[model samples]
Every structure is written in C-alpha cells, then in structure tokens.
Target: MEKFTKISGIAAPMPMINIDTDMIIPKQFLKTIKRSGLGVNLFDEMRYDGDGNEIPDFVLNKPAYRDAEILIAGDNFGCGSSREHAPWAIKDFGIRCVIAPSFADIFYNNCFKNGILPIALPQEQVDILMNEAQKGANARIEVDLEAQTVTTSEGEVISFEVDAFKKHCLLEGLDDIGLTMEKVQAINAFEAGVGATRPWV
Candidate 1:
C-alpha cells in the first residue's frame, strides 16, 4: 500500500448515483485477482462501446480527464455488491481520493484498505468539487489527508471528516498485510516459544 498523506491532481466528475461494482470492472475482468492493469478496464462498460471503442463523451475518455487522479462522484457512490475490485480499479487508474455525498459502507471501508481515500461530505461540498472537476485539464484539486481539507480550483476550501485510525493507516501505507508485518518480530518470538513449549503436542 502507498502512503496517501497528500494528493493534488486532476479530478474527474461522475455524477451518477448507485455506481455498482459491475459497472466499475465487469465480472469477466474478475478472473484475474491481480490489482494492476485494471485501470484500462475501469468503468469498462461506460468507457467502451459495443465494438470496444472508447466512448468519447465519457469523462474518463476525454483527453483532459484521461489522467485524473481524483474522482468527484455523486451521492450513493460505490453501491451494490461488495467487490474489492472496484477500489483496485480506481487505484490502478491513479485515483487516490474519491469525494461524494455518500457511499456504501462496505465500499467505503474497502477504499481505506486498498489505499484509496473515500471521502463523504455534504451535498453542497460535493457540488463544489463537481463544478471544479468540470474544468478538466485546466482545473486541479488538492486533497490534504492530514488536514482533512479539499482545495478546489477556485481556491475554495472544503473540509471533510474521516476516521482517525483509517487516516493513520493510510499515512503510514499500512494495509492489513503491512499492519501485520509491523509486529513480525514479536510474532516470530511468540511462535518460537509456542513450538518449544508444546513440542510434544
């Protein structure tokens, strides 16, 4: 997992609610468990046409938003099935932060586990970010995870709330595996003691 202390980059706006996992990366793409290379297939259905051509109108396909690293989404974002792939695809696409009016509980937690910051804010705040994202290449957004604030293109500062524990994990790049590794020495010592004491068993 990568540390997400501060992120400043392009933000793509997707104002659709109830964006489920299937729409993010179809089930066909789920065959591989790897997280890399999922970016090309992120929002596969929306990005491609029937013939597999890029959809010109989609925000991600547009030249300006092609490299967007943040997403300003609508209400009820990340709804439906609890698929970890959704966060994988978003992260693989270089998006580290997502701001929305609301998000599904499972998906929100998944984001934190995958090194993606899922921010839930009031509708007004999200609306402000959405407007900033509309500027495309010219506009950039800044997310200060430590400060818990988002700076829009117009120099507007919007504050958000996040769990302190989750913030600590992201700042230190500590996922479940990373967290476990932190106690490796202690774990090893404990195992050694257990083996010696219970050798007969």
Candidate 2:
C-alpha cells in the first residue's frame, strides 16, 4: 500500500447510485488474485460494449476522465457483496480518493485497507464536488488526508471525517501485512522463546 498524504488531480463524476462490486470489476475478472491488472477492467461492464469496445459515454472512457485520480460519486456507492476486489480495481485505476454522499460499510472499510480514501460527505457537499468534477481535466480537486479536507477547483473547501486508526494506516502506508511487519522483532522473539521451550513437541 502506498502512503496517501495529499493528492490534487482530476476527478471523475459518476452520479449513478448503488454501484455494486460486480459492476466495478465484473465476476469474470475476479479470477486473478493479483491487484495490478484489474485497473483496465475497472467498471468493465460499463466501460465496454457487448463487442468489448470502449463505450464512449462512460465517464472513465472519456478522454478527460481517463486519468482521473479521484471520483465524485452518488449515494450508496459500493453497495452489494463485500468483494475486496472493488477497491483494488479502483486503486489500480489510479483513483486515490472517492467522494460520495454515502457508502456501504464493507466497501468503505475495504477502501481504507487498500489505500483508497473513501469519503462520506453530506449530499449537498457531494453535489458541489460532482459539479466541479463535471468540468473535466482542467478542474482538479485536492484531497488532503492530513487536514481531512477537500478543496475544489474553484477553491471551496469542505471537511470530512475519517477513523483515527485508518487515517494513521493510510498516512504510514501500513496495510495488514505492513502493520504486522512493524512488530517483526517482537514476533521473532516470541517464536524463538517458543522453540526453546517446546523443541521436543
């Protein structure tokens, strides 16, 4: 996981609500456990047509939003199954932050674990960001994780709340594995003691 301190980049607006796990990466793309390749398949169903051609109208496929690092989405974003792949795909696609009116609990938690910032803001604030995102590549949005604030292209600043532990993890780039590694010396000492005492077993 990469440390997320502050990011200022293009934001793509996806106003449709209830964007579930399947719609994000689709079931077929779920075979691989590796997280890297999923970016191309992020929102696969929406980004491609029946013949597998890029859909021109999809927000991600549009030229302006192709490199968007933030997403301004509608309410109930990431609803449905608790597939971890959703956040993986989003992060792999280079989206570091997601701003929505609300999000499903599982998905919201998953975002933090995967180094993606899932921000739950009031509907009015989300609407403001959505409007700014609609301006395309020129309208960059800034998300300051340390400050817990989002600044729009026009300079409107809105604050958001995040869990303290999750915030620390992101700032330090500590995922579950990274967190465990922090106590490597203690773990090694414990294992050595156990081996010394229970070698016969």
Candidate 3:
C-alpha cells in the first residue's frame, strides 16, 4: 500500500447516500483477487449505460471530476457488504480520501487497510465540502492525515478525527503484511530455533 501523508487535488461531489460496495465496483467485477485494474470499473453501473457507453451526468464521468483524488459524499457511504474490493476500487481510481457524514464500520476500517482515508465528518461540514467540490477542477481540496485537516479551495479548514494507530499505519505505508514484515528478523530467529529443536519431526 502507498503511504498517505497528504493529498491535495480535485474533489468530486457525490451527494447520494447508501453507496454500497456493489455500486462501487459491481458484483461481476469481484471475481478476481487482484487489486489492480479495478479503477476502470469503479462506479461501473453509474458511469456506463447498458451499452457500456459513458454516462454524461455521472459525477465521475464528467470531465472536471475524471481525475478527482478526493470524494465528498453523503451519509452512510460504503454501506452493505463487507467486501474489501470497494476500497480497492476507490484507491485504484486515484481517490485517496473519501469524506462523508458517516460510513459503514467494516468499510471504514477497510479504507485504512487499503491506504484510502475514509473521513467521517459532521453533516454540515460535509455539505460545505460538497459545495466546494462542485466548483470543478479549479477548486482543489487538501487533506492532511498528519494534521487531520481538510482545507477547501476558498481556504476554509475543517478538522477531522482519526485513530492514532491508523494514522501511523497510513503515514508509514504499513498494511497488515507490511506490519508483519517489520518483525521479520525476530520471526526468522524464532523459526531457526524451532527448526533446530524439532528437526526429528
């Protein structure tokens, strides 16, 4: 996973609530275990028509939001199934942060594991960011995981809360495997001792 210290980029406004994991990447796309290449299918149903043509009105389909690295969404974001692919799709799409009034517990935790910052802010604050994101590419939003702040293009700063341990993991680019690798030397030593003692087996 990539380190997420700070992100300053375009924010796409997605005001619809209850955006479930299926709506993010769809069930059909979940067959593969690989995390890469899901970005093209992110919000697949919403971004394409039955014919697979890009829908003009979808926020992500719009030219201004095509490269958005942050998302300002409505309440209950990432609700439904606990599939980890949701965050993978979001991250693969280059969205480093998702700001919403609230998020599903499993999905929220999964975001941290996948190097995506899922921010739960008050409704009022989310609304403010949503409006700012509507200004298109020119309006850049900055998210600082270290400072726990989201600054709007107009210079308005809103502070958010994140678990200290999660923050550290993201800052250091440490996923579960990465965390385990940190103790590789100790693990190797223990394995060697076990091999010596249990050689008969």
Candidate 4:
C-alpha cells in the first residue's frame, strides 16, 4: 500500500446514491486476485455500452474527469456486497479519496485498508464539493489526511473525521501485511524459542 499524506487533483462528481460493488468493477472481473489492471474496468458497466464502446456521458469517461484522483459521490456510496475489489479498482484508477455524505461500513473500512480515504461528510458539505467538482479539470480538490480536511478549488475547506488507527496506517503505508512485518523480530524470536524447547516434536 502506498502512503497517503496529501493529494491535490481533479475530482469527479458522481451524485447517484447506492453505487454498489458490482457497479464498480462488475462480477466478471472479480476472478482475478491481483489488484493491478482493475482500473481499466473500474465502473466498467457505466463506462461502457452494450457494444463495449465508451459511454460519453459517464463521469469517468468524460475528458475532464478521466484522470480524476478524487471522487465526490452521493450518499450510501459502496452499498451491497463487501467486496474489497471495489476499493482496489478505485485506487488502481488513481482515485486516492472518495467523499460522500455517507458510505457503507464495509466499504468505508475497505478504503482505509487499500490506501484510499473514504470521507463521510455532512450532506451540505458534500454538496459543496460536488458543485466544485462539476467545474471539471480546472477545479482541483486537495485532501490532507494528516489535517483531516478537504479543500475545494475555490479555497473552501471542510473537515472530516477518520479513525485514529486507520489514519496512522495510511500515513505510514502500513497494510495488514505491513503491520505484521513491523514485528518481524519479535516473531522470529518467539519461533526460535519454541524450536529450542520442542525440538523432539
């Protein structure tokens, strides 16, 4: 996982609520366990038409938002199944933060684990950000995990809350595997002691 300290980039606005896991990457793309390459399929169903052509109206397909690194979404974002792939696809697509009025508990936690900041702000604040994002590529939004704030292009700042432990993990780029590695020396010592005492076994 990459460390997420601060990011300032384009923010795509997706006002539709209840954007679920399936809508994010679809079921067919779930077979692969690898996290990379999923970005191409992020929002696959919405980004493509029946013939597999890019949908012109989709926010991600629009030229201005094609490189968006942040998303300003509606309420209940990431509802439905607890698929970790949702965050993987979002991160792979270069979206470092997702700002919404609210988010599904599972998806919210998954974002933190995958180095994506899932911000739950009041509806009014989200609306403000959504409006800013509508301005396209020129309007850049900045998210500071250390400051727990999101600043709009017009200089409006909104503060958000995040779990302390999760904040630490993202700042240090520590996923579950990375966290375990931090105690490698202790783990090795324990294994050595066990082997010395139970060699007969």
Ten residues in a row with the worst lDDT in model 3?
192-201
lDDT of 3 by residue, 1-201 (tens): 899999899999999999998999899999999998999999999999999999999999999999999999999999999999999999999999999999999999999999999999999999999999999998999999999999998999999999999999999999999999999999999999989999775
Pairs of colliding residues, candidate 2: none
Candidate 2 differs from the real structure by a C-alpha RMSD in angstroms, to one decimal, of: 1.0
Please give the lDDT score for candidate 3.
0.95
CA-lDDT, candidates in order: 0.92, 0.94, 0.95, 0.94
Compared with the true structure, model 4 gives a TM-score of 0.97
- Which regions in candidate 4 have their CA more than 4 angstroms from the true location? none
Residue 61 in candidate 3, Cα distance off native in Å: 0.8
Residue 90, candidate 4: alpha-carbon lDDT:
97
The candidate scoring highest on TM-score is: 4
Model 1 residue pairs with clashes: none
TM-score per candidate? 0.97, 0.97, 0.97, 0.97
User: What is candidate 2's lDDT per residue for 1-201, written digit by digit as tens?
Assistant: 899999999999999889888998788887888978899999998999999999999999999999999999989999998889999999999999999999999999999999999999999999999999999987999999999999998899999999999999999999999999999999999999989999975
Query: lDDT of model 2 at residue 69?
Result: 98
